[model samples]
Target: MLCFRFCPVPRLELVLLCLVLGAARSCALELNLTNSEKATCLYAKWQMNFTIHYETTNKTYKTATISDHDNVTYNGSICDDDHNVSKIAVQFGSGFSWIVNFTKQEPNYFIDSISFSYNTEDNITFPGAKDKGIVTVHYSEKVSIPLNDIFRCSSLLTYEENHVVQHYWDVLVQAFVQNGTVSRKEFLCTKDKGSTTVAPIIHTTVPSPTTTPTPKEKPQVGNYSVSNGNTTCLLATMGLQLNITQDKIASVININPNSTGFTGSCQPQTAQLRLNSSIIKYLDFVFAVKNENRFYLKEVNASIYLANGSVFSIANNNLSYWDAPLGSSYMCNKEQTLSVSGTFQINTFNLKVQPFNVTEGKYSTAQECSLDDDTILIPIIVGAGLSGLIIVIVIAYLIGRRKSYAGYQTL
Candidate 1:
């Protein structure tokens, strides 16, 4: 039993309490009791979602309902905290409806009467209403009477608005009173008997809902390491080939005229080589706090060496529109790969995408043996040859002069 302290309310508290709450609101739970006749103690742990606006915090019922457990007895000294207790929101014989938690009020209040009432209407509305059937109040408020009436409480607080129905529902909290303080507090709630939905009017019979499973992420392309003998088919499709060992720089992978396997729509074996290297490098490449578009390489400024020792760089070497191929393109999918515009090309030459440092996208260049300004060998050789030729001509000229003089003397 519980005793409630009664006192005069300073405000004109009537009609719907929520109507005067301005922007705030309240509600009561729709309960369905296993045993309505028996006065069994109910325990409930309800969850609510709160919306904080600048100063005020308003709470709303979530999709989940109160987890009701059996046999939770009243606990405390009556009205000790005065945190619980609300006005009669609904009228007597008010059928199944939404429950509401009235905003906490001051002063004090007592329970004059705690009873359950039920009434069924058959206006072609209430579900399972077979020409107005008997729908007993399965769930309702159960206010505990004080074991020891310390206040000698009599003029019980007016059942102001407990019967008034709301669109939502909330748990009802009533406390067992002592002299002035609350000794024990117990929670009560109306069970949802008919539908999972909360409404002013009882909704129709709702079927159990089916849950949807979350989707799994697609696996990114991966790599494999092998020798040339193992990949006879790969060599046929790809014009050029590159191989990189994990963590170690096995060899500088160069793009050549033949690396066209990646230029077509991603087939199982179509783009396998490029797929393998890029994926393996991505795993090894680490940019802890990097964005997808963050630059790895500013400019690919290096001469590429082909298999036959032919060296060349990208003709124009455009970096303005260079997109860091960091993450997989959105069009690239696992099940059915998309057809791309192939690779960069001019005339019949298909441009090769050189293997880059996964993080830096750095490319390597081959040093062609062009004329060097550092060496003086060419100048030295030319100077020696010209001096020798000049000396030979001078000797021949002197010999001719000697021969003419000798001929004159002989005459």
Candidate 2:
């Protein structure tokens, strides 16, 4: 037996609660729909990547990314009897939902639009935007059609309102299938055939002061990627560190994305990657292409919540690090530090990134960072010095062996 009880909450709240409850029961990463004949099948699998830039109370910019499905609590689908239209809703995180509407015309099914709903009450995620109330990022344009096989798109969809909330979406979806099952062919959206470029490197954070550091422990390298279909568009591998001042005491934070949430978005001209945790509210790195041929890290935005209940914000846009050609990556095997702001410093070790024109799911060519030029020259200089020393030693030895014996009278 099922029991029902009515709460006295506001109508809007009640509706939202019901929707959430429904999603909790049906939330799933994959959705399967069958026609009345039961012989035809429609399958949909999507990986959604969202980049949100919001404002704080002090008029500072803050960014957040929602790409991890671990927080997804609800998923539901509705289709008409004739299967002409289908709607799917996925709710994740706190007060956030994505609704996708699909329409089928004859032999093809097309995505009509996608609507993103976010609640401003979640101060932890939308801190200063509390006064904005409910916000929606909608894309009404029709993407492509013919979902019979695999349909994929990774284009950056930008939506902004009042310069307060800016949303960039990178969606990879495959819906509407008449084949018996999903095909095993490699994804053709990009040159890659998988979602990741290399085996992701997982690094644990450094132990606390009281704990002894392990001798074999290496610094964590954050491997972040944004993919659509089987092709990864943005890939970055680097060890991230944050230097900040707390209570006038300087401290360093080694960002270990292995134990935190990491998300990003990829586009042709620009890309973004963000790391989020309780201690570090959000660390966002933005990359952009310039002069249509070169690409570089354009800026970094962050909001740090300290242990002393104080908040530190970083909004630095005057940065141009790790520059390379559009078809190549930037490599820096040595540690590179940038003063993101007067009070905040960012450090990256063994950094390699390719944000545009990636090929075969890997970096095409590498352009060494200018900062690493000296590092590249150290080996050459040392080798030259060693050769010179060896020649001198050989000459000295020959001279000594060939010298006249001063003490030998028989010579």
Candidate 3:
């Protein structure tokens, strides 16, 4: 079973071997300089799109184009276990050089610090040509940008060659450098590039409530009247007529004599009445004598005199002979006066009486009356003898009473 002896590799040799492997894995690569010549042999442009981040700044997305160049190189590599990179250098052919530092290393990509240098061409000298500057591409995890902020980028170079002419090459490099940032200030892209629209705001206002007044009656018109006694009796009447074509008699009063003589041997017979001028249109007065107590129902003779000087008489001796009569008298002995008055109607009339015979055992007396001044007034009169008797009685009473008191003795 035995006879197997194992020899350990030397530390130095193992180290060397590891270094060789690492170097092999980290070997810098150069892209074929003439790979794009089949498409266009003339000087052409190139663009790079990338995203980056820095510990002190925010994430950024950028696009850059190289407009002018004769040659360029793109070089990058991952760091090794020792944080050392074998391709941590950039070579601008024809003796130009730059130092590079790998800041990040991932499974498929890396970010690096860049240094710059210049190389001279044999016969061509680009005016103001010092050296193209180095641009650092920091690594980032994000692929998008904010709407209001800006994304910035440094200039970068890409290289190509002409296969048709050996040793002829071209470099695409940015002609102008933008040292600052670019803003994401554009309106959002839409499916239809030709159309754009904005929404409108709707506003409304409320209204207040309002108030709304109420609607008065008319008066009625009527009539009134009064009367007091025979002889000096007074009467007044009042009324309202809306549409009166002819005259309206609102009140009337009359008196007549019975067939029993109105006079006796000792006194003269008399009767009196008054009426309202305000309510009556026409009025007349007359008197007569009849044989019965129901004289007003018996036949009689009479004459009527109106305030207008109109004379009306009834000689038939019939009780109804008088145009209008007081309650129970058969004869209209005298014509009486009637007065009518109001805002719309006014009138007046008179009455007179004559006694033909007298009997001695009876005496006749006269009455006195007053009327409403506001409405109307009417007065009736007998012979002047009765009036004279009234005055004589008043005077004699005063004089005899004075004389008797003066002669009287006090106890």
Candidate 4:
């Protein structure tokens, strides 16, 4: 007896092959261009109407408008054969529509070309017909006309009805202008094809005016200075002086007169506004250093000491504002002094002061000295106790010796 055998193909492989074939078959629509014969007049004015049709079986749709460049449209129709159609309508999202109108004229001696552009609208459907509840569909197309091709054939003037056509026209116009082939002139004199008249001259007459000279405003005076010790000082408004002292080696003082009060003990090299006090109404103290007696005051070196017993130093690399460096340093016992000097309003002076240092050794010596005194008193107390104990032992020994002598006598 003979047996028969059968084999089945996988469903997934078959579906994939079908999908690839469908994708390969799907291609963009090709645009058709109409050619025209050359004419002797070089330029002829003619009115033409063009219609663009958008069709889709999708029912959830609305009407929209077209692009505004080159072509005028109304109700989905552009210029009529006699240029009677004043507008054209275009559609957008969910079938929205729009219309616009404009006119163009060409010189009789030169060949003229025309083109149109349109705006595209995408249609999307949600809660799809099948198990999947959403679907997106995109529809985008454009039409363009090259300057050389435009002039070559009058029939080829119409461009594709798409959104990007105007951009293409803009590029074409720029290229034409740059290549010196075309020049755009404003038709100011010719409102219509009519008679000519003499151009009018516009003139302005000046009346004899009274002269009340106003004095120029003087420059507001202000002065600001930051020291190497990170101290900041500001003098503003009728001798209003403010001084900021560093409490610690790394203490940065900011004096902002415009603000409520001073801000201090900030990190060095921090790009924070320390002192904002201005000598004048508008002049405020900015972090900057000045030079005097060949000394450079750098602003970036401004720093302050932290209360946590840690030294905070400011980076002094950037010196755009001032020549002096403002920063802080940590020291054991040595007084941390910040020396700040600058010339403000032709007055030069240097300010110096010690900042607060919270290091461990700051009060250690005094504390150690106090502890040593306590130890010295303890030694004296111990010596007195030992003497009292020796006195007691001597008394006891004397009593025992007396008792022994008495016993010997009794014997």
Runs in model 2 deviating more than 4 A are 1-218, 370-411
TM-scores of the candidates are 0.17, 0.41, 0.15, 0.15
Of the pair 2 and 4, which is ahead by lDDT? 2
Judge candidate 4 at residue 404 and give its lDDT: 98
- Rank the models by TM-score, top first: 2, 1, 4, 3
- Model 3 lDDT tens row, 29-119: 2221111112111111222211111111121111111112212333432223234232233343333444434322332122234333333
lDDT of each: 0.25, 0.60, 0.23, 0.25
C-alpha lDDT of residue 173 in model 4: 18
Ten residues in a row with the worst lDDT in model 1? 48-57
Q: Which residue pairs clash within candidate 2? A: 23-74, 27-75
- lDDT winner between 1 and 3, please give it: 1
Residue range 1-411, candidate 1, lDDT tens digits: 122222222221111121111111212122211112222112121211111001001211111111121122111112222345333333312242223222223333344433322233533222232234333222333333333322211110112122111122233333222332333443222234322444332111121233211222332232222123223221111122232221111222332222111211122211222221111111111111125332221222222222111222332223222123432211111132111112212111112221222223322231111222236687889999999999999999999999999999999
Candidate 3 — which residues are off by over 4 angstroms?
Answer: 1-79, 84-86, 104-110, 120-123, 126-411
Q: Root-mean-square deviation of each candidate, in angstroms?
A: 29.4, 16.8, 59.3, 35.8
Off by over 4 Å in 1: 1-16, 19-118, 124-128, 137-172, 182-411
